[model samples]
Target: MKDVDRGALAISAALAGVAGYVDAIGFLDTGGLFVSFMSGNSTQAAVEVFGPGAAVALASAGIIAAFVFGVAVGGVAATLLARPRAWIVGGATVAVALVAVLAFGGETTLWRVALLAAGMGALNTLFLADGRARVAITYSTGTLVSLGLALAAAATGGSRRAWRRPLLLWSSLVGGAVVGAVAHRGGSPFALSLAAVVLAIATVILAVRPSTPERRPAAER
Candidate 1:
């Protein structure tokens, strides 16, 4: 593959779609959020865990922190894992995705936070560990902001591929969010069911690709 495969880009967009919708529904229907974007959550969580945070901010932070811890767990899990092993990892990832929704499906509780966080972190970790970070499913707001800036710069005469891809990413995320919102508001079960299907397919595809062997983390090396 060249520096970046178009095929990979295509796949990333699809996954981003899923992430966008899944998270939208999570927030709209469940009264909480966690589609996969943790970076923002992490920052928000940090603000909360320390000081100068709101109630929702603290909760969001906790959710993000738990999700990150879950990511660490997924990373540890990845250590013993391989490519086709991606299916197994992906399955576990989906498990958490569902848990995130179901936990908030009804009542709002503290454990609900843990449930969503673990799932978000796990799912996000699987994608990253598999060398699929190009597929920015979670935290798409940044993607949108970046894409807009890129498009603006491109219109003004930028020549880099950077602008185009991010714009495309923002579009995909919007499309996904729409699909998710419609499906969820009409029937969360159906929406979730559809998401589950997409996730299963995406996971299997990733599994078929050879696992991108990673450089050992500083701790590992």
Candidate 2:
């Protein structure tokens, strides 16, 4: 197989799509709480705290904590282990699969939430190198911001190639969201399981790829 590093941006975009799909599940499950995107959750937390009372805010806080802990786990694994990116992606698939099973079994506690968050957190490690997040597969705000900048740069006569990566990533995410919504209609467990399958495929691709060159702590494309 060709080296994935050579097509890192493409793989990252695909991962972004998976994240969007899972995130859609979380959104539908929680009625607006984001499992992968903490910014959205934080916003919801604040709103709940002020408007809906402490119960909702508490749940949001727990999700945020889970996400944060998952990020820490993924980051540490990448920094301390070999083939860190592949390991993280593999772990993410497993975590997601577990969450899917639990959901199928009618589990809806914070433990399941933590597993989902951890899966999302592990995905962030796909672009981890030099101790920083690269493309941010789990969130779209940065990707959208980068897209705007890329377009602005192009409008100022910069090369349009700079815009290609972000545009693709954003499109992949939105496309995943559409698929996720549809899959969710079938069943939440099915949608979650489908996401796990996608991540598992990504893990296989990463497992077969050659080692990448040293990376800088730059934002994902």
TM-score of each: 0.68, 0.89
* lDDT tens readout by residue for model 2, 16-75: 888888888888887777778889878878987978567878888988898888888888
Mark the regions of model 2 whose C-alpha exceeds 4 Å error after superposition: 1-6, 214-221
Query: How many angstroms is residue 136 displaced in model 2 relative to the true structure, after the best TM-score fit?
Result: 2.0
lDDT of each: 0.61, 0.78
Worst 10 residues of 1 by lDDT: 212-221
- How far is 104's C-alpha from truth in model 1 (Å)? 11
lDDT of 1 by residue, 1-221 (tens): 11345755666677667767766766675365453666655666566665665776766766666766766776666556655335434754466456546744665464554654565456545444344443344557667777777667768888555677777767777789888888876666566667767777777777676544323354532
Q: What's the distance in Å from true for residue 221, model 2?
A: 14
Q: What is the lDDT of residue 2 in candidate 2?
A: 15
* Predicted structure with the largest TM-score when compared to the true one: 2
Model 1 residue 108 CA deviation in Å: 5.7
